[model samples]
Target: MSTTQPQHRSVIDAITAPRDSRVAFSVEFMPPRDDAAEQRMWDAASTFHDLGAAFASVTYGAGGTTRERTGRIARRLSQHPLTTLVHLTLVEHSAAQLESILKDYASLGLTNLLALRGDPPGDPLGEWVPTEGGLNYAIDLIRLTKSIEECRDFTIGVASFPEGHYRAENLEADTHWTLEKLRAGAEFSITQMFFDVEHFLRLRDRLAAADPVHGVKPVIPGLMPITSLRSARRQVELSGSSLPSSLERRLRSAKTDEHVRAVGIEVTSEMAERLIDEGVEDLHFMTMNFARATQEVLHNLGMAPKWQAAA
Candidate 1:
């Protein structure tokens, strides 16, 4: 007997296709640990869908610890209004395990993925180690995903570091690694959270100068609004990103939660404006499972949905 596979559409094409020539927008979510958190995540997903997000992505936890949760959420999100992207990583699983996970995603009609070499579960800054039968680099995972018969039509996205990955030898090496991933079949990339738009511009210019052809792949800038000072600091430490002194000062000076939120919206809105003016085709917000800040930022940019406007 012969079997048939479902026709798959590429997320890269969905995002890049001109939508009245407007800039595209997307959001990222992390897997929740408990039922309450899962409910919150779904609520946030609903908000993003209603806001007309171009696509949404769920992150894989460090060391693949959240594999089941990530898969469950990805499957659920794929059935939602927005196209969902699942994150795959080489951290603690064997090659066969990875293939099985890919098969599960394929069975759910998911065709978008974000490939990565996940961080160490114990300490992200600690020594890197590969699983006994798993791949090492993200390029290897990208190739593996493509090799899977069920995932042949998947549109893969890889991670990029505008400020250079923490473990990279240098900025030049980091850029080269990003290029390698793109050449290995990653259709596009989303950068680590950055406070300075100039960093993203520099990274884009360097990539463009390096290859001039394949380097032109869409490198969407990632932004996380500073809803809380403590969380912002923690994210900076975790991401190895430098917080701009001015923004840090503003966050520190804000004595009230409301004030801090206002500052965050203002700062992120300003950054978004600058990025849009500089020709960035898309903006990916790290929603952190809270949609209000992201929604406000998009509203400030006049990109919010008509329903939001009416509300």
Candidate 2:
């Protein structure tokens, strides 16, 4: 399929004045590590394009490992109809490198960014050692982006954690930092993945209760549908948290691999249904560079597309 650039708007602008009452769904993508994986990623993109994703994301790799790949892919996605957000992370890169990257993005005609303080490269749970002249916090990165001439007017977003940041002293402190980011000029926030819909509801409520105005700005909850038992376990591990015992037990008891995947999809669909019922402005699916699991979940929610028939 060929790409066609369209007039773009900030995600905030799009969400606040939504075209309809329907709860919209967005998507997240990771940098593919090789040509084969890149083709798989493009195939998934084609599927979502047919399905009409609200918006899409391409982000800095863990510890900025895939920095170049992310920028290259983000530029490509921007040319497509999808309103793609390119993630900017203050991980291990120096200030000069970050500036050059931002300028490159601006020159590429990119208009959106999601600022973050990326986890340590080797181990997400490892000690975070900031680069000598790089920023230490996401808020600082947001401010930096705003101060940059080309990126200053770009729509920016920040990351939120429903369970509280792993390194945060408490949930209150976690909320405090997030509020600070909003004050620093982030237009919206996208949350890290969490299983229980209650946690998402609580976090959303907490933000509204914390700052009745800016905190009420659109918050997009992100999740990855478990495509397999092994993938689910790996996600839980990489999250630096444990799965609820019930989910772990259910997955463990599956008699066959197919059963495990089926259970995962069933559980995800149910949770997504609850979120839609809660009336969220949007649901963000971390597609992991594939579409089947997310496609299945959306289908379960009665949002089916004709990609199979049309393509």
Candidate 3:
């Protein structure tokens, strides 16, 4: 017996669609580790439902270790109003396994994905070794996914670094790699999280100035509202980006958790405001499975959330 499939929306079209507000926002959530965490994620999803995120993306664990859990989360969230995007990484799996996962995603009507090469599991900074018969880079995965007819209709996106991925020789080379991924059939790109708005501005300018033709993609700036100075510092370190010293000092001087969260909301709001004023189409928040800070940031920016129609 055959059943009807659920219709999905395109993020490329979502970002480009007309809106009452010039700026739009999206969210990123990590796979929950336990039942309690799972509940929290769902709660966050429900809270942000009215916040009008263009789409919600689920992140994969290092080396694709959380593959099963990530898939389950995506499946659970598929029932929600928000469009869920799954993340695919070629860290330790073979080509056959990757293909099967892609087919499964198609079956579930999750047609949007973020292609990533992933970080080494044990030590994120450790050397990366591509598995036998598996793809080596995100570009390879994008090409392979698009080659499969069933997956050909999927909207593939890749990661970019405003301050340059640590593995790259320089910012120029980093830009080259991002362009290559887009050229390989990635419909759009979202940046790694950064504290400084200037880095994002420079990256945007760099992409446009570097390649007039193929390099430009709908780039969504990824941001994490800093809840804890210590946690934020560590995350930035792992992502190979630096936290602005001025913001760092401000976080350090905050005495209590409440004050720290308030600082985070304030700084995040200011940065987001700057981005909106600069005419960015979308802002992506790396919500650490929580909704308060992101909600506050949107509020501070006078963002009136709506259930935006997905394009």
The top-ranked prediction according to lDDT is 1
Q: List candidate 3 stretches off by more than 4 Å.
A: 1-7, 62-65, 304-311
RMSD to the hidden true structure, all candidates: 4.3, 2.1, 4.5
What is the lDDT of every predicted structure here? 0.84, 0.81, 0.83
lDDT, candidate 1, at 190:
93
User: In what order do the candidates fall by lDDT, top score first?
Assistant: 1, 3, 2
Taking all chains together, the TM-score of candidate 2 against the true structure is: 0.93
TM-score of 3: 0.92
TM-score of each predicted structure versus truth: 0.92, 0.93, 0.92
lDDT of 3 by residue, 1-311 (tens): 01223237878766666766558888999988888998888878767665567788899764343666787777776667777788988878898888998998888888998999988767778899988998888988898899888899999899999899999999999999998888888878899998899999999888888877766677889989888888898998788899888998999899998899789888998999999888887889999898877887887777755223335
Q: How far is 58's C-alpha from truth in model 3 (Å)? A: 0.2
**Which of the two, 1 or 2, has more TM-score?**
2
Better of 2 and 3 by TM-score: 2
- Residue-level lDDT tens digits of model 2 in 1-311: 54666437777665545543356778888898887888888887777766767778886775343666776787777677777788888877888888888888788767788989888878888998999998898888888788899888889899998888889899899889899999889988998888877888888898899999878877888878876778877887787555778888988899998888888888888888888888877889999888888988888887864224335
Better of 1 and 3 by lDDT: 1
Worst 10 residues of 2 by lDDT: 302-311
Least well predicted 10-residue stretch by lDDT in candidate 1: 1-10
Candidate 1 to truth, TM: 0.92
